[model samples]
Target chain A: MTSTHDADGDLAVRTAGLTKRFRSGQVAVDGLDLAVPRGAVYGFLGPNGSGKTTTIRMLLGLAHPTAGRAWLLGSPMPDAAARVLPRVGALVEGPAFHPYLSGRANLARLDAGDATADPRTSRRRADAALDRVGLSAAATKPYRQYSLGMKQRLGLAAALLQPRDLLVLDEPTNGLDPQGTREVRHLVRELADGGATVLVSSHLLAEIEQVCTHVGIMSRGRLLLQGERAALTEREAARLAVTTRAGQADAAAEVLRGLGLADVARDGRALPGGAGTARLTAALGPTPPEKVSAALVHAGVDLVGLEVDRPSLEQVFVELTGEGFDVAR
Target chain B: MSRAEVLDGPGAGLPVAAPAPVAFARLLRSELRLVLGRRRNLVLLAGLALVPVVIGTVLLVTRDSALSGQGPAFLAQVTGNGLFLVVAALFLCLPFLLPLCIGIASGDAVAGEASAGTLRYLLVVPVPRTRLLLVKALAALTFAAAAVLAVAVTGLLVGAAFFGVQDVVLLSGSTVPVGEGVVRVAGIVAYVGLSLTGLVAVGLFFSTLTEVPVGAMAATVVVAVVSTVLDSLPQLSAIHPGLLTHHWFDFAEFLRVQVDWGVVGSGLAVQAAWVAVFGSLAWARFTTADVTS
Candidate 1:
């Protein structure tokens, strides 16, 4: 992991030891360290009750973190936010559009420093963004007429009105159905590909797993894990499942001991059953596949089948958080 | 540089170029848009339009001989009655309503966005909280000016159209010509603008304190109502002039023939003082607020 203050393209966002404690003494965010590279779609993933929203607020200078510092687009928190803010666009929390205004007008009002952008230009941008988010037909409709998924899309269009370098979206697909979810996912990918550093925080682990190149899991006011998806998976041990003959179970176990290949355990228990008419699982911690196979053959174990299992990010998350994972809807 | 040269120097462009005409102005402009862009703002404007027509119709239908003693002619009655009624409308009715409007206008000024979740969006734009409050307060001031202007202009035109010209008599027994009365009324209109600053500041302060737009607006109005009631007390005459609620109605006294700058000036001073105090509180609160909905 490259740890540096100044990254590139204005460094997008940086926070060090950021902490926020509510007046009621509940620590919302504690000792958080976040660094988002410019133009990289950084997905912020955490279970509910995590400090995702708090961290987002602190980064935007919306809420003052109790301790530590934050920098956005190279400016310090609350101090340099004005100069840095115009260049960034964001959609935080609920879709709070003026219910009376049309979808297009709502985005028009939110567009910063676009006062000189010809009304026609604004209209075109609003229309295009709305269309991109699959809300083109709903442009003229009142915001109150919009459904939750539609509102989420409208909020996104509002955020994308001006070509901002960074997008801070909180649960962008919160109320979206499968189709709406796909649209947002595609939009996020395209935004990152277009060189905009995207920070999307959500409780949806599956969404983060599918699209995020870099992931940060926050839990209980702390950042539990953050890294490239592949690297975190690589750190875990590889497992192989095998079935054997019952007659040579004990003899195979002795042969495996002679060959020093009997270190594999079943269900985390000591290797009690040998090559019986039973299934056996083995662990290979960062070892080459060829070596494991050779050790099995040399031990004369009746190997019926050998298959390598790749653990999903979901499994790793469940193991790390010590909770039942939510089945992604 | 001499003060004269500084005054005469390139309007806003100076030797060093002053920082963005008024940081508060842009903030104010945005805040104004927040108010004006809403449908409720148009409704408020429409409501103000009816004041002149409604008051005019009532006078036409009633044509009471009793009202003639209150004022001599149509313009006198209209402008005279209009000034007081407008003051009542702006100060009393609006305190209860407009502050709420302003409170609603600005109520969500920060919190609305926070609650709606757009506050973070605005903040991420890196707008300083001070700038945000300044802009929002300024916007409310503009609307305050607009609300007062709406009543003054509409009421005067309707009064003139229906009643014709009438010499205005001040409380001091000095007579002001119809034309001069118009000018003074304009001045009074301007004064109303200044007077409203205190109320707007109060609304702005409440705006900073809460995320609920209605709550902020209602609180300012409640405070205004309570203060107005206290100021109206017969025993508090000595201290009444100091309360902003007392000064908001002082404009009617401007209709007097020999303009009493003493009372007017004091009223203006008191209102300005309230503005400074509330404005400071708003500034401090906004600058230090966490603003997380």
Candidate 2:
């Protein structure tokens, strides 16, 4: 086990064919293999009930896996859960606390339960945590009286109580308002900047797109893709759309076909305001935009406008997972 | 370089190592706080304490009525020896009130956390599932002991206030010194508490079986009630000694002069067996159950 740890200290999380099946015969998670690099704001993105939370539960040892195994920071799980979990902070699903206890008292109780936490300093740490989350004003308030955003912030505070090597936040901004969402995203960015690997799960592509340095997309309990954000975006195919004179559309299509562009197609809709110009779209492979323009100009085809349309991460995600990305999920 | 080393090298601020595994003692302390802190549990305890007050007041007000000779063997002695009020309250409570309270408390132990969504957080502390279950069981038992004492103390105080403390007469038609009588009352209280340990274990087992606290509580009480029902039927005599509540009243032997150790020993053995069996079941269920909430 230490072999993996020694070979890649930068790998904060690694799983080998991890799987979980409920007794009720529901396969919550299929065989999943994942690796999260250290110091990354890694987004665990998947639709609701797509096994994102289930996988997180398995990673934290909250649920037992039917097959395979996982390692957190190089420590094998369930076996090293006690040692590994203490180094990791997770806010799974959502915030949950004793409704009767004040937020401060809740944190105090949780902190006391950690053997590494100094009881004498728990109060100080709790106060600092509340302050960090901008919840200092409501620190003494009972958790039941808190708003949804406040509860989320309190959960964030609990995760930040002790300095951690990894933070697993499952939809930390689920119920937060716009302002609260911004605050949590900013916090995630800061935590990663401070060198802590953060695995933040969310169904919203835009939410993770703004803060995550790396991403893993899942659908139907299986991981579809995992990599740095830039690499994934770079791998997506860019399309070239050319506006040509109505009579020259077929000519341009034939030129692109002759140039080895097999995916070329005519735009279904006429140009804006029913213009006579025809729009032709082609999948741009290794060919450069300049080369396509020169080819059109050389062919004596009337080229009105040419543009390269890059696919957004959402599009790439949908293409890979074969499902609509519902932010609410 | 390791992530920790990078974070510690410059502006990462105060360096902190990974937290250590939580101690069982700490988990237990937290569990106790949760059990005692709930208003529902507190109200239940207050209600248990009220039982002895009502019994004592009713007995005091009707000292000359037919009620004086109408209840348990201890009831006739209540007016003569105030300590019997403690005995009478335990007698009344053991059958239903005591077990009801224990069931509600223990039943809420695990299921309540699950329903409230706190179980996930607690488990992610990676507080070994077994350890969490153990802490919950220990807290339930603590509540059990406290509940029994509450009823006994209230009975003792109310009885002493109305009838005055004095030497207690044995149920066997013998007399004991006042000091000896005090020791016997303490013994009776301890015995009553020990008798409920099986119920606590059973309640904890039910708690592990559901996420709904009310369901667990009702099932636990129903199980105990059904056992009592089985114990009463003469047709079930062969299984009487095996019933969970069959020897619950064995503490009454403490009121006798000779103290029938044979009966008391068997009662304790039966409770021990129940605890061992049900406690194992609870541990098994809790450690393996899928906490989807």
Candidate 3:
């Protein structure tokens, strides 16, 4: 199995012990070696104050890291910023623009900042981006008058002004309506389909769980778990469920413990046999269930059924971080 | 996945930055849109341009009141030579309004963007920090030029309408043609515009020191006010030559029969020195800033 902390392969963003210590003596990011594979919808999952935004800031060359190095699209940061940032689009923290200008004008101004943007095609690019986010209707309205959802969409439009290799969106769904949130999910999936790697940071697990192919969970400025979404849950230690007659519950529990299981419990579940049945469970370690079943049968305990219950992603995260995630929204 | 995926995609080798001029043009246009498009800036400029008109109109109303020579040095001659109104208007505005206006604009350059949360976006646009600073300096300087010209042109039209055009009497009691008078007025406008560069540099340095636009603006105006006050003290006359406002009225030197290039050149040299010193400090602070906003 690949190590979760390894950043050895074709990574769009690779940081080696990236650390940010503010002048206030606060350590915002601590030794974060974040690895985001190319063409991945990598979710940077963390609660508020988990250093997700700080990490993104460091990656984009906005803030200098105290004691580490980072590379974007295979080039060193701030050094290769002029070269690398052109191929990168970012919406860090939130969308910000000249409040007095119309949405279209703000976008044009931002697009013009790109060195590769053609002056003649600037208007066209800005219009196309606004249209893509379904913001064409209000494109001419002053940005300060835009709704929260509209502002977020405008930020997304600015990021889409150019076809970028990597997009680092910090809380892209912030302040969006449910419909707007769904649209953003679709947009992220579409961008990934078009071969763009997206590093989206969010405090909401559901937001990350639905769209991310890879997840890196962080807590208190430290990354606790990182891996592909499905692989992470599959990699967790699943529990085992065992069923037998109520009268034989104690024997089955003893037999499982004797066979080297942990947290052995005989769940008081009444089977169709009317209180004559028992449901036993335990933390399934390396010991195979087949061996346990045979051992139970030889020990004269009635083993009706036995199987491993796959662990959920929530369980895996909670286990690793020892902190609950806002998984609801 | 690798860099090949991004590089081999459609429009992969799109030049990261256009040729130098083309790229600079884009940065310049966007910055112009921002500085000129802002309502607050427009209001500030209109206010700066209003002073000359107000002065011209007041002088026009009181031309027969015997209050002629009671005001500024050139106010007495404004009725005789309309161009002196432009000179007097600049004299009045220079003491406070001009520095205050440029201080607000220049001070807002970095701190405004920082407070608005746009500084991070601009930096991430990969505008090299040095390049962004250069564009900002240019934009503020452009606004300064516009401010001074606004005062001169408005003062000229009002003065011309109030008093018919004629020869300009030099401080040496000699006379020059009206055409020469207009040219000297233009030269004064240019000189006054150049004079504000030092203040712009000071404002920019203050802007780089904080994320609060109001704080930078206030600090910049304070520096200008302090310089003016310090230049006023007779005991501090030793250091007056080094102050930002000391040579601001040197444009008056043009009212002389023979222009003193020595005085004007030294004034410009002081501006250059200020730009070199504070401009470098601004660059250092900005390039090293964390940009958390």
Candidate 4:
């Protein structure tokens, strides 16, 4: 990964050597540095066992660091949390509400203070936030009566009502179905556009790759990689195709040796079509597509058609994770 | 209210002062609303409010023969079997039961959010740990008062109902008439409030210590029970009186023939001492605890 020191007052959060360990001395978040700019949708990505949530908690001062420091909105964490919190909002870990309280009342009850909110105004805010999250119809319904996705929305609504500068959401889509997930993804983009700094952590790399301007990856309590989303996946290579006379296909493979494309295989026998025609596959490392195509034509062995496929983020994930994970099915 | 005001709300150039009393009071009110707004809490309050009426009726029903044997003097005095039962019920049971309930209520106040994952929401918002703990403690204290009053009011009404309102006899053979007895009872109610202050603090302290509701409730109850048991033993009586639970029943002696103001006063002092000691520790621990767990 490429690293450079960038000096800018635009950072919403900055941390150096941040670490946390539980009572058993098991480190949950190791020494790590993170920089998230204001008004940026930062995605914290990692596997299930990674410390994404732990890092977020420490950033909010909900949890103390074992041996490092962090700052939010230009102020030190925990001590400065109070001064900065009024301007920030967040939903972490999971969605929970007082089971007996209506969804709307739950938000209204989360008091900025007890000036005794005008019930009407409080309801309007609660309803508006809920409606924004598509939970308006369930506003009066008790939390226990709602589904998991609805509860998640209720939590998001509570955080949004504060008119804060930042929103920290952890696994906000864990229990969501496809539809709910799409809605939340849209909301994240909309909130960012409206000028809220959003820091979301999730195991869904594809989703993160789609919405985040910046991304950080953690594993085994340590940050493995972080940077602008575009720069992280630059290792994509090109795909190649070849066609040659029947038995001559094997001969054509030897001629392309200098390109470093290996493991060439033919579609059928290495014999020509009618006279001699064969097809093959090659692993090319971001080689020029036109060069590969022209090389085949120059060989005098009949060249058919060639195609190239660029690498995807999924491929990058596998490379980072040591290997592609196996699917249960 | 004006178009200009509406348009300028975000950048109106209004200098924002530090949220002082407004923040604190709003926090306190939020706490009160949470504790008092629940139906179950109200039910508990209703039960306490009707204690006097219940006692009056039970006594009126059984007053014919059993009433003749016990003098109004013994009835007013808290030393007799009936009043002792009342005192035991309020002082012993309430502290154990009510504090447990309050702990149950406030126990989940912070940790529940952690477990539910909403603590992140509150923490991320930067609510001061000290202020958060204070608000929670205030909530528990309000519940504690309600819990204590429930027992005291209920006990007082039963005593008045059964004994037919008369002079209260002190353990020292001193006597105070019904008018004075009422004043003393009010004082006793207040004392009960003070006595449970430590329990409230304990529950709240435990609440911050762990994320489990049952764990907090159990810790608070166990500490109270153990302390009370330790204080009840005659072997430890000398040192026990200094303990908060030791003087929990000191108010009972007030109903005796001669009032022992010295003992009652000592009990109040002990209660206050426990409150300060436990309260300070609670705040300290809560402020330093890591919210991740």
Worst 10 residues of 4 chain B by lDDT: B9-18
lDDT string, candidate 3, A111-184, tens digits: 77778777788889889999999999999999999999999999999998887888999999999988888999
Candidate 2: where are CA atoms >4 Å away? A1-7, A239-308, A327-329, B1-22, B64-68
Query: Which residue pairs show collisions in model 3?
Result: none
* Pairs with steric clashes in candidate 2: none
Q: Is the docking of candidate 3 incorrect, acceptable, medium or high quality?
A: acceptable
lDDT (C-alpha) at residue A217 in model 1: 77
TM-score per candidate: 0.81, 0.87, 0.89, 0.80
Worst 10 residues of 3 chain A by lDDT: A1-10
Model 3 stretches astray by more than 4 angstroms: A1-9, A239-266, A270-312, A326-329, B1-15
Full candidate order by TM-score, most accurate first: 3, 2, 1, 4
**What are the per-candidate TM-scores when only chain A is compared?**
0.79, 0.82, 0.79, 0.76
Q: Whole-model Cα lDDT per candidate?
A: 0.68, 0.85, 0.86, 0.69
Candidate 3 residue-wise lDDT, B163-215, digit = tens: 87789988899999999988888888899999999999999999999999899
**Candidate 1 segments whose C-alpha is farther than 4 A from its true place:** A1-13, A37-40, A73-75, A113-121, A242-280, A287-307, A325-329, B1-31, B64-111, B172-174, B234-238
Please give, for residues B1-293, the per-residue lDDT of candidate 2 as tens digits: 35675355322343343333447777788778888878888998999999888988887888887666577657777787788889988988888888889999999999999998888887775567887888898999999999998999998898899888888788777888888998999989998898899999999999999899999999989989999999999999999999999988888788887898999999999999999999999998888777888
Native interface contacts kept by each candidate, as a fraction: 0.41, 0.53, 0.69, 0.51
- Order the candidates by lDDT, highest first: 3, 2, 4, 1
Candidate 1 TM-score versus the reference: 0.81
